[model samples]
Target chain A: MKQEFNITVFSENHIGLLARITIVFTRRKINIESLTVSESAISGVYKFTIVIKTTEDQVKKVVSQIEKIVDVLKAFYHTNQELIYQEIALYKVPTDALYDSDQIENIVRNSGARILEITREFTVIEKTGHKEETQALFEQLNQFKVMQFIRSGRVALTRDPIERLSEFLKERDAFLNSMD
Target chain B: MNKEPMKVTGSEAVILSLLEEGVEIIFGYPGGAIMPIYDALYDYDKKITHILTRHEQGAAHAAEGYAKITGKAGVCFATSGPGATNLITGIADAMIDSIPMVCITGQVASPLLGTDAFQESDVLGISMPVTKWNYQITTPEEIPDAIAQAFFIAQSGRPGPVLLDITKDAQFGELEFSYKKCKKIRSYVPETPVDPFKVKAAAELIDNAKKPMLLFGQGVIISKAEEELKAFIEKTGIPAAWTLLGLSALPTEHPLNVGMLGMHGNYGPNVKTNEADLIIAVGMRFDDRVTGKVSAYARDAKIVHLDIDHAEINKIIKADVAVLGDAKKSLKMLTDNCKKNEHKKWLSEFNKAYDTEFEKVIDKDLHPTKEGLTMGEVISKVSEATNHEAILVTDVGQHQMVAARYFKFKHSRSLVTSGGLGTMGYGLPASMGAQLAAPDRTVVAVIGDGGFQMTIQELGTIAQNKLPVKIVLLNNNFLGMVRQWQQLFFEKRYSFTELINPDFLMITKGFGINGQKVTSRENLDAAVKEMMDHDGPYLLEVVVEKEDNVFPMVPSGASVSHILLEP
Candidate 1:
C-alpha cells in the first residue's frame, strides 16, 4: 500500500536546503504532506521533519539521495510505526466554547491540548501527537469553529534506546565480558 | 638458547603469532625499522592479504573500518616514531568508538631509547591516552606473548585499539621458538557481573523515580546490548537520550529516543536530562561534551553508572550508584527487578517544548537562495535516498560536523567517523575499509574538498580493487571547518584556508572510476543515485556555498547555553 513516510533530517543549518530537499520529493512525484526545519542545539545543526507519501523502497531512495547532499551530515527516515511521530496543531477555537461550556475543556484535556493563549474573544489550543491524531483533534474542533489551524511536520525517533556509537562501545564491553 | 627462537626476529614472531591468531589480512606499509616485519610478511604473502596504504593513518583507520563491520580484530602495522605517531588520530578514533584493532609499530633499538634517534618515538607514551592498552616489546622472547596479549586485549572487554611497539633490536634478536598460552594479565581485570546490591538499588530507583532518563553511550553499542536496552526501556518505560558518538545504540526512529543529547541534542531530551529525578548512565564515561557544566547537569537526578572497565568510574561525573559490570548484564538485572513507572506529565510537557522549539528552527530560513548549493541541502537529499542505513565515514572539518548534523544512524556500527581525533584525510580510506568489511552494504565518505586532497591518494587503492564506495566531496574551495573557526574566533582572517584542486570528475575518471559534479539541487539526486547504483567506486563533487557556517555552535570553553546562532 502507498503509505506516508516522514523524513526527519538533522543537518547543518543553511539557506535554500529546504527547496533542494523538497525538490527530491517533488521530482519523484512523492507528495510532501508537510515539511519543517528548525535550529538544533548545536549551532551548526538544523533539524528537518518532512512527511511524504511513498513506499518503503521509494522512501529509502529518497533518504539515500538526501544523505548525499554536501551540507547534510545525517538523514533519517521514520515511518508512522517506527518513530514516536508527533506534529503540533494550533487551533483557535471559539471563545464561547471556552467559557460557555466545559465540553471544550474536557476534550482539550483528554487530547492533551495546552491552552497557549486565551481571551474572551478566542482560545488558542495546541495539540501535539501522531499526525493522524492531531488531524482528528482538529477535525473534532471543527464543530466548534476554528479561527486558525496550523501543524508542524512530524518528527520521530525509534523505540529502541541504544544509540549508534553506544552499540560500538557495547560490542567492546561484550567482547571484554566474554574474555572475563 | 633454543637456537635463537628458531632463527627469527621479533618482527617475524609478530607476524607468525598473528597468523596463529587467524589474522588473514594485515594493512600496512614497509618503513625503516619495521622492515623485518615486511620481510616476514613476504614469506607469508600467499597466506595473508596485505594491503599497502598510502599512510600509516590510513592503515589504522582501515583496520578500524574492518573491525567495526566484521566484529573481528583488525590489524595494522606501522614503523616506529613518525609512523606510529601518524596513526595516533585513527587510534584515538577507534578508542573513543571502541573498535577492536591491534596496531603494531617498529621501535628504535633499546640502546637508542630516549635519544630521539632518527624515525624513533616513544610510541607507547604517545598512544597512551588513545589506546585501551599498550606494550613495548624489549626482548625477542616476549614477542609471541606480547602480540597474543595485544590481540586478546584488543578483542576483549569494550574492544579498543591496542598498541604494540617492538624495538628494532628485539625484532632482530634471536630467541627460542615456542608459542606459549597466554594467562590473564593480573592487572587488567575488567568489571564482570553487577554487584547484586547495586543492581537492586538501581532497579528500585528506576521503579520509583517520577522522572527518569537513560543516557546510552558508545559503551552499550560496543557491548552489543541493543536488544537488552530495548527490553529494559519497554519494561521500565524510560525515555532515552544518547551522545553524538552514541547515534546507533538505539534506532534513531525509536519512540522512546530523545535523539542525540548534550550541547547539540534535541530540546526535550537535553533539557530532560537536567530535570529527571534519576539518570541511568550506561557504559558511557561522562565526557565534557556530554556533561556541559557538571555542576548544573542532572542537578536533581541521582546517577547510576554501569561500566565494564572499573577505571572509568568516578573519572568524570560521580555516580550515586556505581555498578561495575557489563552494561548488558547490569541492564538485564535492572529490567528483571524494576517496575514500570509512568511519567506522563513530565513526558507531555517535554514533548510540547520539543515540538515548539523544533518548529521554530525549521520554520526559519534554512535553505540557500543563492546560485550555489548549501551543505545541509545536499546532505538532506542524500539522507532522504539512503534511509540512514549506509555506513558513513567522514573526514575532519566542517564536512564532519555537517555530516553528523544531517545523518541519522538507525543501527549500531552504521556510522564510522573520527570522533575524538577528528582526523582529516580519513574519509576515503575509512570508507574503503568499511566497504571491504561490508561489501554488500553501501559505504559513503563525506569529505570537504581540502580534506579530500589530504587522502585522495587512496583513490588508487579504491580504484585498483574496484571497491563499491561512494565518495562525496563537499567542495567549497576552502578548509571549511578551520575557515569557519577563523571567521568566528579569529576575526574572519581566512588565513591559508583556500584550496585549489584538480577537477574531481576528471581525477576520478583518470582512476578508471565513475565521477560527476553536482552544482544545483536539481542535479543532486540523479548524480547521487548514479553513484549508489554504480558497480564500482564512484566520486561525486558537490559544489557547496563557500563561507557557510554551522549554527548553534558552542564556542570553545563556552558554556552550552552560549550557542552561536545563524544571523
Candidate 2:
C-alpha cells in the first residue's frame, strides 16, 4: 500500500523552518524523494513541496506533524491523481553525436524536448514532463553519449479551483475573531 | 499605552525584557561567550536572582522543576559550544514532558559564525529538533521580539522548550529598548476551539457506557482542570486512574481515584484498561508504556481523547470521539452534557484487582518481612514524615517508580519527575528549583544511587544558596531499572549495571551539607526524621536490597492484561 505522495506546506518565511520540517520526516525514518522550497503566490509566505513514497497512514501522520510546526500555516498531502505536477530535466550530449547523424534530433523531437544551446563540445536539451517521461528520454538519449542529466524536484498545483492556504487562513482568522 | 523607549546595551535589553516578563530567578552558568549578559546581570542583582549551577544541564533541570511547580515558563542560560551542548539533555527532557522552558545560549560574534571561531557552535541547528521553536539573533534590535516570542511559545498551548541563540555581537550592540509581550502569532494558534458536536458525541458515549473509565495525564494539571476533572468524575461516578505525570492531579485519597497507570503502574488500572467499555482519556497520550501492544490494547473500547494538540489525536490509538481543546473547557462541556450516574459494579471490579495486586506485590514491597530495606518502605516513610504535602522530585530509575507509587499527594503539582524522557540526574537540581518556587513547601528529592551520581555537583548549588531540599538517596548499588530488565529479558548479564563504592556521607560533607547513611531497618524511621527535621539541605542515603525489582510489570510488547507480578 506504499505509493507516491506529494506533501505541500505553506508557512511564514522564517529561518530554520526547513530544518524543523525535515526533522519530522527524519525522526520517522522516512526518506525524502525530492524537496523544493520557494516563495508562494502570497507575500511573506513560502511554500514547500516534498515528495515521498509512503503508506497512506504514514503520509497522514507526517502531514499532521508538519502542520504542527510553529510557522506552518497549513499542510496537505495529495496522490498523483489529485495533483498536476511536472519536473524539468536537462540533458547534456556530445555535439559530435548530433554531427554524426540526424537520429539525435529525431529522438529529441519525438520526446518533446527542445535544444537550449549547442557548442563544439556539448549540446544541452531541456524537457518539462513527468518523471517517467524524463527518464524515458534519458534512456533514449543514453545511446547518443549523453554526458550528464539532471532533474528538478516535482513542482505541483492542486486540481481544485481554490487555494487551500487561502481557505485555511480565512478559517483561522474567523477562529481568532470568534475568540475575541 | 505608549511609553518612551530607553537606550541601552543589548545585554541590558535582555535583562529588561526578562524583568518585563516578571522573571525573578534564573538558573544559569557564566562562560566567555555569555560574559556580556552576565556583566549586565551584575548590576540588576536585586531585580533578578541568578543561581549559578555547576553545569548547564543542572540549570536546565532546575528550570524544568521551577516551571512545573509554578505553572510558568522556566528560564535558563548557557554559553555556546560545550555549555549549550550540555543543555541538550535538559532541553530534550523538557520537550518530551511538555515542561515550558526558555533556554538562552550565547554564540560567537556574528562575523565569527560559520568561520570555526573559538567556542562557536551551531546551537540553533543542534537544538532544532528538540525545541518547540528557536531563533538566532545577530542584531540587538531583535532581542526584545525574540525573547517575547520565546516565552509566548514556551508557555502556550502544549508547552515545550524553546531556545534563543544570541550572537556575541548582538549582546554588545546598543539599541533603543521597548518590551512588548506577545499575545498572539498569526501562524501559530495556541488554543483549539472546542467542537460542540464532538463534545456531545463524547458525552453520549460516556452516558451510555456501562463501564466507563477515565485516564488523566499532566494535561489535567497544565490546564488547571483538576477541579473540573473531579466534578466530571463525581457526576459520572466513574473510576479514574492517572498517568505518572498526572500523579498529583487528584488526591490519592479521592474515593473514585483508582491508582497509577503504565508499565509499573498499579495492577488494577493496567488490567482494567482492557475491560472498560469506554475510555475517556483527558490530556494524556496513550504512550507505549501505557499501552503495551497497540493492537491488543483496549481493542473493544471506544476512546474519547481530549487534548489541546491536534497532532496527538489519532497518532497512536484512534479516537471514536476526539474533543480537541483545552481539557478544562472540554471537560466542563462534557460534564454539562452527561447524566449523573454511578457504576458501583464496575468500581468493585477495580477494587477486586487492587486487592489481588496489593496481596501479591504491594504488601511485600511496602512491608518487607526479610533482609535489607525496600525502596517502597523508605518512600512510604518519607511520605509519612512529610505528611504527604511535600513536593516529590525524583530522578529516573527504579526509585522513581517506587516514589511515584508510594508517595501520597494531597495537592496539585506535588510530583516532578522526568516522565517522558526519564532523565537521570534530574532530581537534585530540580529539587532546588522546586524549593525556590515554593519556599513554604518542603521539597524532597528521591534519587537512586546511580542517578544521584549523574548530577551530584548540584549539592554545591544547594550548599551555597542554603536551599532546604531533602535528598533521599535509594542506594541499591546498581542501575536497578536496567538491571531488572537484564534479569528478566536479558538473562541477568548485569553488564556495567553494578557500581563500585563511594562514601556518600563524605561527599555531602565535602559539599558542606549534613548527611546520614542508614543500613538497617531499625534506624530507618529516626534517620528519615532527622533528615526531614533538619533546617538546611540534607542527604539521607539508605542502602536498599540489591536484587529487588519492581513488580506488576508488563514486559515489552506484551499486553497490559498479561502483566507479571513475579518473574
TM per candidate comes to 0.70, 0.99
Complex DockQ, candidate 2: 0.81
Report clash pairs, candidate 2: none
Instruction: Quote the lDDT for A119 in model 2.
Output: 97
> Which ten contiguous residues of candidate 2 chain B have the minimum total lDDT?
B1-10
Cα lDDT of model 2 by residue, A41-159, tens digit: 88888999999999999999999889889999999999989999999999999999999999999998998999999999999999999999999999999998789999999999999
Which residue ranges in model 2 land beyond 4 Å of their true spot? A177-180
Q: For candidate 2, state the interface root-mean-square deviation in angstroms to 1 decimal.
A: 0.8
- Candidate 1: stretches off by over 4 Å: A1-180, B1-11, B108-118, B128-130, B172-176, B180-183, B362-371, B485-502, B554-567
What interface RMSD do all candidates show, one decimal each? 19.8, 0.8
Encode model 1's per-residue lDDT on B463-553: one tens digit a residue. 8777888888899999887888899789989899988877888887888888889888788889988877777888889998888776545
For candidate 1, give the lDDT of residue B385: 66
